[model samples]
Target: MSKVALVTGVGRRIGIAAAIAERLGNDGWDIAFNYWQPYDERMPWGRDAESRAELVRRLDRAGVRSLAVEADLEDAGAAEAIFERVGAELGAVGALVLSHAESVDSGLLDTTVESFDRHFAVNTRASWLLIREFGRRFTGEHGSGRVIALTSDHTVGNLPYGASKGALDRITLAAAHELAQLGITANVINPGPVDTGWMGPELIDTMVGLTPLGRLGTPADVANLAGFLCSPEGGWINGQLLYSNGGAK
Candidate 1:
């Protein structure tokens, strides 16, 4: 049977999220993608409609239906809008991947309440709100759907972004427990210093040297794992925080 999957914060990047979306699409999963507008200071993997449209085209070529929605997921209503779009365009969501988020690079002393609010809005509130809406609507009987959130290696770090991810990590676990009653498995994927656009080449090289894999993670690397987690083959897995880092601290 075909399924529907929602991937947020996807436009351009190394390839992890995109790879994940394509993988799901290839596996007969319809896709709903989200992209936040890019700032003028940077252009990540050509962060534009063209890039996403191309991805949608590719998914279509692969024989899967797809739709791209522009949304400010930080807003409380953003998740609802996305679901509504999917309901109208696709069908029930078989998987929800909360992959759209970022950091402002604020430190402990520099961290302000406003900044905290901003980060939590995108990284936390958005995910919870999506879960609230999706969880309430998605019935597990349709082959057990998945909730896979993108997290960071912050559970072991004290960075602001790390703290934000840690909060997401906790939330995923909690959701896993609560959503289990509905037969949905909630989990978080914490990728370490991936070579994605977020971490530049210099840092990636350093991390590669430090890691057991001896190679920086590509978007496909993370996406591959995401595919597995969303598969019925992974039904035995739930409420776990898995790392894709190559054994680096």
Candidate 2:
């Protein structure tokens, strides 16, 4: 039977998240892609509605059932809303990619409670809310399910962004243990600086110079890992924080 999956922040460059979405779609899973279209336009590196429309087209062309929902994940019930749509339009969620986040880069002294809370509102809380909601609904009737979130090496820096992810990472790890018998394997992927809109060409070059791969980590690289974690063969690899960072430590 075909599996259903939910992928967040999957429009435009979609980053490694899009690769995960496309890989699952290609592998016979119905995909539910969520994007923060309303907030995307404000960022200098943002991809607007038209840009996301192209992503929908690409996913549709791949011949997989795809639904694109524009939701402000910080809007309280957004995660549940997306799940409702997926459950209504698709069938069941076999996998979930908690890849959505909201933030403005801030240094230690420059950060504020509002900023940290903002990140939590989306990055930290939304993923867990979605996971918890989905867990209540997922019944392992078909097979064990997969839950993966895109974390970042940034967490090591202990900066605000990194702290948020560190918390999110712990959430997945704990959930993995709690859901162990239930057959829901939860894990996280920490990708190094990719050319995703977040980081520019110069930054990518600098990051690549530091990496052993001598190139920026591509969405394909992360996608392949995501596909594995979502595959039947990956049932044993649970509760791990895998670094998919081009050999970057």
Candidate 3:
């Protein structure tokens, strides 16, 4: 089997995608990541070019082949193009990890149609297309294939991101059964409230108080679970939505 993993939304080293990529690379998997610079530039935290470059360097030092592809997942063709490029560069992918999201906070009445459509286009639609392409071209050994999607349950103030993630959960969970003949294990993970440079001090404090752990989740915490799910032992945990939050209610 080709021990290649395609992780999406790896625009910054601090992000969960980058952590997952590093963990998988350390586990002897070749890494192929997708990122969109425009998305990072628009976000409140902005882009981290140096951190991204450092991540590549770290992967190189770990002795695993790594390919970084700049792609806008909002484009319908991006999914197929990504797969084609990764296949050409790093052989067939054995695992697909979706960590990308279109997150813009807006309320129920305030969310724009453009924002809603864009969210679904990138989060929901792009994920479906990527999974479709993965299923079509998967040549890994039976039971070695994996699909993992990072999702969220927070939908109060964040309408589009949360709603699209709901749709993503269903799409990803379906693959466990739908792609069972191919021996793929599909699962969704909700890594609740990882700061990753998005939260202010006040919000961070509030989130910490809400959790029993009394600390904000870190990217490494999510990466640990992601790494496990892509491992051979994780093949039994399929078609489930796992909450890795530290008892946050």
Candidate 4:
């Protein structure tokens, strides 16, 4: 069997998760992707169930085996279920791409206990559990294990959202150090201000002006970086937060 990659939050067609899955599929990896339809429905850019089915078709066209898992990461048992399903269906996972997030916007004072917990459950707690499970199931004989997480720098009004992802970054970095002996590389990619249907026209224009590259980031841009980091060439890069945001700083 070919190597497998497990990517989360791939409910939408025009999403970073989908792009990353496609890139890995093209690079000779079968895909086992996870998505929560309800989460996508609650977001600004809504996603339909058909989109998930279509993504599977696209991956099939790319000549790679594909499996779509419908799961909600807010559930505590989600991480284990994801790994188990992928393992049962695709043999073993060689790469894990964490692109799922709860994108609720709220200030420090406005953030409710429920909201904070939800974000933490999905973004922080679930991520660490997924990484832990991957490490446990990883086998060096198949190939080096790759863990790539998508993160952002929005810590202003997005208190819980940003803070939760911050925890994910820290744990991912720690995983890089702890798992290096097993040939597993852990890294976070901060794709700043990506225009994945969330940004309005004015917001996109303002971000474009702020970016040194004079353009907003596309999903493909993030996918390319993820592809490189999961490849053999990226074996030496570990425990680092690499920014792929068109020089936004």
User: Residue-wise lDDT of candidate 1 within 1-249, one digit each (tens)?
Assistant: 458899987766444677788888887788988887663125444455466777888899989899988888768899898999888898888799988776666677777888788778888888889988889889547448799998876533345677777788888889888887788998888777776666777776778889887787778888888889888898778889998777876
Model 3 weakest lDDT span, ten residues long? 47-56
> Which ranges of candidate 2 are over 4 A from the true structure?
155-158
TM per candidate comes to 0.91, 0.92, 0.98, 0.97
Runs in model 1 deviating more than 4 A are 39-46, 140-143, 155-158
RMSD of each: 2.2, 1.9, 0.8, 1.2
Give lDDT tens digits, candidate 4, residues 1-249. Answer: 468999998988888998899999888899999999999888777766687788888888889999999999999899999899899988888999999999899998999999999999999999999999999998755338899999988889999999999999999999988887778999999999887788889999999998998999999999999999989999888889999999886
Can you give the lDDT of residue 247 in candidate 2?
A: 84
lDDT of 1 at 89: 92
Candidate 1 — which pairs collide? Answer: 15-219, 16-219
Judged by whole-model lDDT over C-alpha atoms, candidate 3 comes out at 0.94
Worst 10 residues of 1 by lDDT: 39-48
- Model 4's alpha-carbon lDDT is 0.90
Taken over the whole model, the C-alpha lDDT of each candidate is 0.79, 0.80, 0.94, 0.90
The residue-level lDDT of candidate 1 at 233 comes to 93
If the candidates were sorted by their TM-score against the true structure, best first, what order would they fall in? 3, 4, 2, 1
Q: Model 4: residues >4 Å from true position, as ranges?
A: none
The best candidate by TM-score is 3
